[model samples]
Target: MELKQETQTYEMPHLLTYYECDETGHPSMSMLLSMISMASDEHSMALGMGIEKVQATGGTWVVSGYEGQLAEQQPVFGETIILGTRAVAYNRFFAVREFWITDKEHNIEYARIKAIFVFMNLKTRRMESIPAALIEPFRSPIVKRIPRLKRPQKLNENAPIVEKDYRVRYFDLDANHHVNNARYFDWLLDPLGRNFLKTHRLKKFNLQYLQEVRDGEKIDSKVNKLIENQKITCHQISSDNQIDAIAEIEWY
Candidate 1:
């Protein structure tokens, strides 16, 4: 079926807090992703598809991947920003959602991101068809083909790469009983070190999740050493002898 030109949207105002920001006093990439995620949950709740309702179908929504661009000028702690999201389109197995963060007046966009989500069976821990009762309330069109996001480039394994290992902690899990999608950003970028992160700002990023990272797992995050003239970096996260996720980021 063809989707409508207009889709349901939801927006809310959020006040940035000190904890959400880094040393630059601006919201960090991980926290920025979390804010938009919060908006998505609120959107679902407004449509009467809260966690309880969705979980009743024996499955929950999982973010498969995200692609986004960040404005050079970002919102700082103590600033009020608007978080907005819309149900773009969906198929039986995948749904695309768009999100944005802007000043309260909506004059300047701080970040714009699009995420692809899949319904996953909690018990089986595998992909499942999205139930109509959980998704139809948003009124997004059902399409035979859901548009795919740009894929991130893979890293050169033989190249000089920096790697850091982190153990999955209890706090990393969200209500879905899986690692929170936003936490991956911290692992992906941390290998770049403090100096680089403080000096550069992210312009664009694409993150693809190839496998799930479970609790107590010791995961290795690796990134190619930055080239002097190149502003792009490739990252990979691996655990249990498998590549769990990969990301490509462009910096300013």
Candidate 2:
């Protein structure tokens, strides 16, 4: 495919709010993910591919995984931050996008993340080829070799694991009509408990979503209780004997 209009990057400003922050006064991981996701949505809308437009083709965009790094210093509530994203590349089966959170001046970057997305058939819930209308505007080079994100480490079952169960709630559903991917971070991190979450800062993470988590299903979120001296922890989300997602988090 020949390249066309290529305004690949899109950026917007967001005012941090109290509700998005945790006890430590920084935006929670899940909210951080959500904010970047909003940027991506805005990017698509700017290119005339809104959710309704995309869904009209009988499919929707879904994130398959994310890998990101965070700085020790984070923006606090009441501050204005910049959310930026760009379509990196795409292939017939997948698309890659990069995102960043920074101060308004772009001097202090709080986080840098990348996600792999796939087109899924809404009715059949199966993978599909990327629609040229949905992807061509970004002008990301269509390559046979799409980049792959780092695979998260598998949970060590032999190690001491902390497990918590949660019921999928109606509120968890987003515009895609499934549990929002960002909400999974809440379930994944809550098992770390309050004190630990307050004291530690997440430095890096990789999360892979293997299956869709639907509303009304009972799910288990588990994390290794024994953190490596390296300050790394492994997590898993599962339901009905199947693993739904897995992640590895590195903390400072």
Candidate 3:
């Protein structure tokens, strides 16, 4: 059954857990992303394109990246919050989804997200056109060009940058057999170390996943301080000198 625009959104109750929060007692970026990704999956299942059905299509959904902001009033550990997502739009190879976390009353929103997803063929691991049967339920229109989020700025390779290395852990591998998209946040923020992360809060962030990092791969996460904007930091992850991803993060 196709979902009408009026009912295309899906919401599920979530209880913030101590494990999902950082020393600041706020949700970590990685875990928060996992919440919305889970909500997107739930929304898909409700529309009849659950994991099994999607797998049968011989392709899997891949998150290109996300652009979002955190509100000042964030939910604390143990708070029950609402995680919601709406299948916004799609073209042949890409889909756009919007997500949010809000209070039960929905009078307060903790965060808002926009993400781009593409279908990748299982064996070939190359992008493929989204199957009509798969996307028909979402009731989004197909267009020539999919919408692009505010992309993270590219890293200036010529500039001096601080760097740290991370080994893709077994636990970081999600069902897709790759380093989970959420785990990138861990690597991205960890380079700043505990002091900076605990002292400041993320106000806005934009990320772009140019390549995938698989299990057992060593990634060098680098940070370049913006000369013009001291408050802003630019980051990129490279494997064997090849960039896997780039991002821009701002804090308050």
Per lDDT, the best of the predicted structures is: 2
Identify the runs in model 2 with alpha carbons over 4 angstroms from their true place. 1-7, 227-230
Residue 203, candidate 3: Cα error in Å is: 1.3
> After TM-score superposition, what is the CA distance of residue 102 in candidate 2 from its true location, in Å?
0.5
- How far off is residue 61 in model 3, in Å? 0.5
All models, RMSD in angstroms: 3.1, 3.0, 2.3
TM-score of 1: 0.96
Alpha-carbon lDDT, every model: 0.90, 0.91, 0.85
Ranking by lDDT: 2, 1, 3
Over the stretch 1-252, how does candidate 1's per-residue lDDT look in tens digits? 112225688888899999999988999888988999999999998877889988888988889999999999999899999999989889999999999999988899989999999999989989999998888888888999988989999998889989999999999998777788789988998899998989999999999999999999999999988878679999999999899999999988
User: How many collisions per candidate?
Assistant: 0, 0, 0
Model 1 regions more than 4 Å off: 1-7
For model 3, how does the per-residue alpha-carbon lDDT over 198-243 read when each residue is reduced to its tens digit?
7778888999988889889899999974354366778899787888
- TM-score on alpha carbons, each prediction: 0.96, 0.96, 0.94
Candidates 2 and 3, the one with greater TM-score: 2
